[model samples]
Target: MQFDRKGLSDEDLLRFYLAILKPRMIEEKMLVLLRQGRISKWFSGIGQEAISVGAALALQPDEWVMPLHRNLGIFTTRGMPLHKLFQQWQGQKEGYSKGRERSFHFGSGEHHICGMISHLGPQLSIADGVALAHKLRREDKVSLSFTGDGGTSEGDFHEALNVSAVWDLPVIFIIENNGYGLSTPVSEQYRCESLVQRAKGYGMEGVCIDGNNLLTVYDTIKGVREYCIREQKPYLIECMTFRMRGHEEASGTKYVPPELFVQWAEKDPVKKFEEWLLLEGVLTYSHMEQVKASMKAEIESELVRAELGGPIVPVTTEELEDVYAPVPEVGTDKDIETVRQFSTSRPIRFIDAIKEGLKSGMEEHSNLVLMGQDIADYGGAFKITEGFVELFGKERVRNTPLCESAILGAALGLSLEGFKSMVEMQFADFVSVGLNQIVNNLAKIHYRWGQHADVVVRLPTGAGVGAGPFHSQSNEAWFVHTPGLKIVYPSTPEDAKGLLLASLADPNPVLFFEHKALYRSISGEVPEAYYTIPIGKARIVQEGSDLSIITYGAAVHWAKEYADQHPELSIDIVDLRSLLPLDYDAIRASVTRTGKVIVLHEDTLTGGIGGEISAWIGEHCFELLDAPVLRCASLDTPVPFNLELEKNFLAKSRLATTVDRLLRY
Candidate 1:
């Protein structure tokens, strides 16, 4: 019943025992709170405490731990105040997340821990980024990420492993193979003999161990830490264990077999570890009693303090806060003019302008890294980053695999590790591959944890001649609908460069849509230096009083051409640069002056940015309007491969006709 101390002192062993008991005591109290309806549901890590505590103990103070919802022992081991943990459960403003996120979805920058998200697999890739940042900075600190057996089935798991292996990042991916991923068992999750064996495919070392054995868990992590640091590579440790309690407080044990629970009860990590300590004479009977009493008293004290603190009152103004970081004014008009004067002033393609902006950003900020599929060697699908790898080197301009989820997830991690990342989706249509990470992880991280996820996703969008459906599509509407995301679809070369620079500077998740059709077609003078156009500001491309055309990206060029042909109609063109924070002031000024409006876009007619603009005008500017609002966009069907059909699908003729109809109305 005794465990070898190995190199750990008596105090270290006692500290480990305390780590396991603290979370158990806290979880038991929280379960009571849940039953009383004073708190929300609780995810109890009753049996799996040893794994969290042991691994946390093995890591250095500066090392980061991206814990899952069940790893409450990690917080206890890291010296997080017990009252803050209870305050978070009570939804108090004093907690780590300031009552924004209840439960375990919180992280502390001060403690070098990442806040957990419900989707478990994405954290692996984020941990990889953190590890990568440590490697880039020449720091020996490692990142430990935890996930369950069910999470391994997620695409992010494979993506994280692959990227970490390929880059040789100092990350330890710990898979707590708890018998079930909720109701589904490991047998149903994967057909493999063991999850650890899968790590070989990624060319990394893997191991399986008895997770409940606290000494084995601690020793293994200690060795793994040394190996990862010495070799500068990722390691996967599959800790075989069981989730003794129900998935959550609301979940019943009806799905679990009584005999299986009885079997696991015998192997209860806390009981096993306590008996070992008693038998080894590390603790006498009185000592054990004192330890239990101390933990109980501590929990009671924290609970009282948390109850007295009360819950945060919901405020209308607080809800609007922390949407995006305040945009920093980099320079004045005179500084911008000076930048323009110093550089070679020449006309460049829209795509080239974007490349210049990226170059300027990298030159200015060493922390900025570029990542995408074929961006390094192939220069991307469109040659945007052709000479980037040679200029910035492979370390900064990385060539990632076709794993979009990891690309975004890792970008978030890099951002958290004090680096700004610009991620490129090979094409706009392919962004759907990583939509979960983009919508859930990237966009919501800043809002949830008050952390800056400074990531800019450059998407090549829109269809013109014959690029078919998959390669070409305007998907800006999908992101615009998502809160906490800034959408920028620039129409001109100057705006493309300026807006991209601005997106890079902003400390929020920005989806920068580069119109593929306008990459080569649009050519204009662009500033050579880093001059950012303010995000959420719409540019008035043309001035008129007859009618207004609110459009962006490729449609802006079409609107300009149409306006030129029709001299009788004094059309005002409002090119919306940023979609999320829509420029209502400029939009209202143009719409009120014209009294008739036509909303245009390249996305599908049904459910597009055009619809949002039309609805807002109808609601707010209805009295100012002389006629009804009209919209001109692509057909609901997919983009056709044929040149003629594609042109007809997003025809300038259709837009011109819509403008005429709106003007006549």
Candidate 2:
């Protein structure tokens, strides 16, 4: 496809030039603020405003866009207030993203702009997912993501592009080739002549545009966007712009050669567009001055408004604010209605239930996709998704390489593209490898910018059957401490199926814990249709007034077994499917009913769920408890390969043992 520059009118060029003046001024004023100690740093877009503004104008309003730190021009051109932009640069609470993000981080949920991450090209994967979502919803919305020329070196960029190319996703990846990365020149960054040419490696289209020419850049992006929507293909657009300023305020331009600086400064995009507008008679010199004056006055007003609000006071609670939309209404009595009776079906085994849940959910929602290592034809390591490829086809159920970090990093891009993805870590123990991508990048995106990322991560956790420490382990505690994530560990197949479905539907990132021990250990009947068990709710498995035992995952089954054996002792069992949002209400109710409580988990004693649960119970339900709230967990040691040693470290919570312990207490 080619840009029809002749079709463009003077009016289009005039408006485009006017849109860039504000962002350009914002960049200049921010640099001055940095020097005046009003801001800490600034990444100027003096010579590159045209490319940023032009690309943003080419996309539809609801289409997704992920911008790099230097692309503030794009957001400003798309209606981001400069005062809000200044507030972000000054680290104020009234900043563009409500103090959640730093300078260069701005997004609008209403416009469908995904959040930004500092990591190079990581948002590229998110853009892919966002586009995938649009495709699933049968919407024409596309996703556009930007990165610096240096970002192409990151694995995330390549991974996202490869996946998008293979899937024919509606995405456009833009590389703002601004001559240098910090002090490092482009020649040192890559061997390629232009960044766009790298798209050939992923079997995608590529184009280069004169970044200084606003009309040329805008027309090229418009053509490429049309191709993306109509052909459903990803494209790499390389805009050859120049960085007239240093990488940041702290860095002087001393490293750059004087000759190159003068050359780019002479071709300044803002100036070129302004002069072109005057020559075309679309705008007068006085009209240009009026626009600038209006922008300055508006920016000054926003600055005053931003100063009215200061830095945010952190949330006191460990858990984030609740985000539960579309709560399921209580079903009418099954006996009274035939439809209600049909909906309330019998429970199924955790393993079978999970498979059926995924199948049903995938069929019901086209935007829902399953991806991870060995998930497609290999059916996942534990066969939890044994026949997913056959059911959803290769497009939806995909297998990936063994790199856990890449799997997660790529999923971030796909989520940004608008696809809700369920990514498996193969084994819960291996999730540590991708912890940076999950905790640092994905989990923090929403907190960084009030943006939503709907992605589900499934990890097979718990120890038993001699998988050894490397494979057999529950790592929920590691993530529980991390904010901006929801954790769910379900014991039964029914709860597993329900929780997995619910997690998929959640608007933010969810970590779904599946126990390897329960994969095929038990069997039960389940409904053939779709259903969801809420993320933060708890289920009372067995009720008693004597004592309360709180547990989740394999420990829940063990707790149940112990309760069954000790018929003489009265005990209450509560399975906490959601970990981040501990069903404290149910726990408190159980604690109030029985004045004694024991929290248990398969993980080590230190920093485990038991410790947190025990502490919470002590703080909130302390007066109601007759006995001290206690916790039982495995000994603090690596999970040994020997069966006897492993069993010795396991919490002794069998029915008889638990009953005897409570009686002694």
Candidate 3:
């Protein structure tokens, strides 16, 4: 049988080998750099050089590559300088992995290298998302994410691959079968004979190749890339490579069969590629030697240049300072400024405001969609989406399965597809179920990639009603602790409408905390025309220099009621619209002016949002405070079923009492 291959030009083949060989050498040098304390840590793509180089060279410059830690050759082929790559390991400012990223984490905004995560399996899912985005945007770009055979064990790997196949997304999942996953061998990792066979489950074409052969790697990936463009199909490339080194420089492969390492090393990619290039007249022996010398010299030069660039300025304690976004202009317009007037102008309830905001946002931007348990025809538990189905149709306002992970995960997919998703957690307490999807996945998506996951998570929080602990509990503190998540808790209808609209427009992932107690009871005016209060901004419900009443959600009203009664003890009120990006500026400024402070929240006093606010005030305005940051929170007990008992157990009117006590302080 004769096989006809549209082979590469001799010049191209030589260039490819030379390009790869240098990075392989750099990989070796990086190990030494690691040991010498010049570099932090290293995940050398030693035996898998050909696979990395080939896939990188085969893809178009505009096409995206989401590589793992063990794919330095891919980085090098895509013009990531050795010094910068080294500087990354050395924890230098010049390193391409941005100062914020870990040593193994790498990629470039300029090169279209969409983030390389150290964690296994999820890269392919993100790459699939990026590919989906490309398709929607009508951009001719393919997204490739590399992983090891071990990563195939992860559920996300299969989920992402099947989704890609179903959507006909242009993604190439490269499995560098390097024999072992840390201490575990492939035999232990999977029962399957080869990783490529797994693709059959997803109904996609799969290929296995000699990963050590640079020519094979290049031709295979190039063929797949061409086929993907022509067929508009996803692919699974299983490169049967070896791992000459352990997972990282810190670990040694002592447990590996010595003979296995010896056997694979004999088939070293650099030498194999050189031999094939020479056999095909692609390069002269002298040319091979020159390439090696050039690579060595180039790497050496980069090391020196990188060293001269200086060590990374460690992110100081002060630098992690001011973590939140600029205080959103919550009441930017004069009409929206006065809370009492805004409330009286139109008595729209909290649930009504949520429905109105979703309707207005959807009407304003076709990209917005609402999803959650019973949010479609059932109109949510609070009947927030009562008329949404009739107005927006089933497609825009959809119901989801009970799987919190699945619901949040699908929202992630939809958001990546450029649809702004407003996902609601049935209750604030149930948010714990989907917390991983919210914090680990969605929150960090933007910071991880230079892209944004514009999403709004509407969580019904607070505990004054007799719903009990299981259903009636505030969990805002859980999210405010997470940096990338934006937490917004509005006290009234106008703020709810404005903040929800603002959250829809904001680039970051927002957690809109709606108090279940306030849903029907709390009513305020909403504007006829569409308007948005900026996120991270605060509302001074009242102005007084005597004492500062800092609170959010249902507690805002309690503070206001108390302030009205005691006209002598002046109280300055700050209603934090957003928690994660808390209005620290407003809090600091209010404390500075009033000289007295009281932090109040509905959750338990043990570790509620009040502690965070108090600590922040102590950090920023401690000297100005006449009294210690006074906190008013619910007793550290589960909310009871009795309405009166629940009210006493939670921090409903506690803010009013705390204000009275603080007046004496």
Instruction: Identify the leading candidate in terms of lDDT.
Output: 1
Positional deviation of residue 227's Cα in model 2 after best superposition, in angstroms: 4.1
Off by over 4 Å in 1: 333-344
Candidate 3: tens digits of C-alpha lDDT, residues 275-357: 66677676888877887887788889888887887545666663344232232343444324443444445668888888888
Q: Show where candidate 3 strays beyond 4 Å.
A: 1-5, 153-155, 158-168, 187-210, 213-235, 311-347, 359-455, 464-472, 543-548, 558-572, 588-597, 616-628, 637-648, 653-665
Superior by TM-score: candidate 1 or candidate 3: 1
Error of 1 at 73 (Å): 0.5
Span of 10 residues, lowest total lDDT, candidate 2? 331-340
Candidate 2 lDDT at 303 equals 74
Question: Across residues 1-665, which tens digit of lDDT does each residue of candidate 2 receive?
Answer: 12234666767766776677878877766667677887776777788887878888888776778888778767777776656666776777666555556776667776666657667666787677677767766778788888888888877777778878877888888888987888888889999877888889889899888887877888888889889889999999998888887887678788888999888877887886677667767789898899899877877787778677766676645124422223334334311133334765565667788888788778766877788887888888878788878777887898775656656765765665556778988888988877877887777777666555677899888777777888877789998987778899888777777678777877778999888778788765555556677778998988898888888888887888777877877889999889987888999999988988888788888988888888888888879988777778887888888888878767752334654576677
Candidate 1 per-residue C-alpha lDDT over 1-665 given as tens digits, one digit per residue, 9 for 90 to 100? 24668988888888888878888888888888888987877888988888998898889977889998789988988898888888887788888887889688998887888888888888989998899899999987889999999999998899999999999999999999888888888889999999999989999999999898888899999999999989999999999888788888677667888898888888888899988888877878899899889889888988888778754687866767766666666777524456677766689998889889899888878999999999998899899999998899999999998889988988988988889999999899999999988898888877777877899999998898589989878888888878789999899988898888888988889999998888888899987767878888999998999999998888888999988888887989999988988999999999888899999888999998888999999999999999988989899999999999988888464986787677677
lDDT of each: 0.87, 0.77, 0.76
Top-down lDDT ranking: 1, 2, 3
